[model samples]
Structure formats: C-alpha cells, structure tokens
Target: MGTHYEGDLRVALLDAAVLALGETGVDGLSLRGVARRIGVSHAAPAHHFGDKVGLLTAVAARGFELFTEHLAEALSGGEADPVAQLPLLTRAYSEFAENYPEHFDLMFRPASVRVEDPEYMRTSGIAFEALRAHLEECQRRGWRGEADSAALTSAAWALAHGIAVLRAHGSLARHYSDPTLDAVEDIAVSLLF
Candidate 1:
C-alpha cells in the first residue's frame, strides 16, 4: 500500500485534516493532530502551513478547485440545455461536500479560511462563475420564469449548499432519513427544477 509518510506531506496533511474534521469540528482541528495522523512529527506541517488556519485555507482552496471542475463537467457534453444542467451542477456541489466533508465545511465557514487570500478567492470565484453562467443561460432561454438570473442562481446555490451542510453534519438523518446519499442527492437535485 502507498504510505502516508511518502510523496507529499502537504497533501497528506490536508487529507488527515479532513479526516480529523469528521472526528471533530473546525475548532477542534489541529496541525499537530494532522501530523500525528500521518505518522510525521507534529512540527512537520508547520513547514508548509505555518498554522491551522493556513492549513485549512489550503484545504478550502482545494475544495473550491474541485468544485469548479465538477461544475464545468456539468456544463460539458455538448448540451445547450440549461434547465437540464441544473441537476448535474447541483449534484456535483452535493457530491463535493459529501465526499470531502472537511473541505466542504471549511469552504463555507469564513472563520476557518483566509478569504482575503488571492488563491482562495480565485478558486472560489471559479465555482461561483460556473453557477452564474448556468443561471444566465437559463434566464436567456426563458427556461426559468423570472428574468432575474441572480436570484435564481442564489436560490439554486442555497438549495445545494443547504443540502451539503445538512448532510455533512448528518442533520437530515436526525430528522428524516434517506436510505443513502445518492437517494438524498436525487431528491435534492429534483428540487432544483
């Protein structure tokens, strides 16, 4: 098996941070604990991340990068059907949150990330722009009843983000249960259109 001790410690540390986030929330996340999880000395992560916030910012940045990629994929396949794309786009958002719970949590919580950081801002903007573009297309095609594309975009994002947050925290399970994440995702995606 590939070892966590090898290759890139920076990547390994971020992965460990995500795992730790599942065990404990943002306040409980620690650089030292991440290092120990990866079989490295506690001080090792400091070389790349200086501190916990720095590390989390990196993780959030990665999350946005992945989120943007998934969003782009939704827009691909030579389909001009904006309405049809909504489910794919939102599904991608939901999957990113569910798949990378730690990064997803930090991605939304400003306290854990340095929003002023250029890389973080740019990465997040990519994802935002992708969503905006789809909403614009929907508006242009009159697929949505309203001409206010911005509101449409915000509403769609709210639905996806709410589902992501609720699922990540297992809030949905506490109230009503969906047999699986996929089932919940399908229900959430259907809500978009």
Candidate 2:
C-alpha cells in the first residue's frame, strides 16, 4: 500500500525522480526507486506517471520549462541588441546545464523520454523559439550579415550545447580557466554573427 502523500503527489514524484536520476541516470532509474526515495510504495510512481518512460517524459518537460526560464531571463537581462545577447544566452544555457545536470541529461536524451509528449514538445519548443526569435531579430537588423537565420540559430545552439556538454563532463575545465572559457565562448559566438 502507498503511504498517503498529503502534498501534490505528482510534483513529489517528479522531485524524487530527479534525485533518482542524479544517482542512477536514465538507464538505471526505476519507478520503484523514485517511490522509495519518497517513502512511498513502489506502485506510487507508476500510479502518478503510468510507467518509466512517462515519468521520464515528465522530468524532461519540467526540465524544459526551467530551461526556458533561464533563457528568457538571460534575454531580458542582456543588452537590447540581439547580437549582443547571444553570449548571455549561451552563458545561461551552460549555467542551466551545470546547475541541473540530471534534468539537462534527461532533456536531451530523447531515447530516454517520450519526445512526442505534448508538454515536452511545448516546453522545448518555447525554449528553442526564444533563441530563434533572437536570431531572427539579428537577421532583420543585418547584425548577422547574410547568414541564414535558421542556420545561424542551429549553429548557435550547437555551440552552446557543445560547451555545456564538454563542461559537464569536465572536458572544458581540464584545459581552460573560467575566463579562458568565457573568451572562447565569446570568440565562437562572434564567429556566428
């Protein structure tokens, strides 16, 4: 029997799942493990999330929501010029990845979560659209030269994602200081514009 969870069971399960993800990763995460983390019966997570994939999909969706917030904040906090905002957004992306490693891992691993899940699509789309909108603005102002905005957005995302992944895995820090990394990221973003 599941213990009575007085709070929002769905949110509780998601929180426990994130902790479980940090410990076990996608392959090792189980509904039973998440439930156990919260002192509930193993069936509790299944009841809330249908199955492991469903649970992971929820985690990914939540991750995207948070990721979008970070990007939006970065966009608002930076200069009005879209070209100038690229580095800020890029820094936010890396910071998000660094701060939320488990969510970051689950968000990008489509094989681990249902990419077709509507909430997943909506939240992830919002995050990407923020970047796309900024890139479009840059194109409109001719700040990015004649490069196709769509391609530029993709390149920008790739660069930021690459840096995040490299830093998360300790590859970037092994070779570069924080200032050096910032300089490298600035140079890379400069190349895009």
Best by lDDT: 2
> Which lDDT value does model 2 have at 89?
76
**48-137: candidate 1 lDDT, tens digit per residue:** 888888888988999899788766875687556877667666666777776777777788889778999888999988878778887887
Look at candidate 2 and tell me the lDDT of residue 42. 91
Local error of candidate 2 at residue 184 (angstroms): 5.8
Q: What is the C-alpha RMSD of each candidate to the true structure, in Å?
A: 3.9, 2.0
Q: Please, what are the lDDT tens digits per residue for candidate 2 over residues 1-193?
A: 4778789989999999998888888889988888878888898888878999999999999999999887888678649887777777777888899789999998999998899999999999998888888888888888766888678888889998988888788888777665344664574566655
Instruction: Give the whole-model CA lDDT for all candidates, comma-separated.
Output: 0.77, 0.84
Q: Which ranges of candidate 1 are over 4 A from the true structure?
A: 1-6, 74-80, 170-193
TM-score of 2: 0.90
> Residue 122: error of model 2 in Å?
1.4
List residue ranges in candidate 2 displaced over 4 A. 174-190
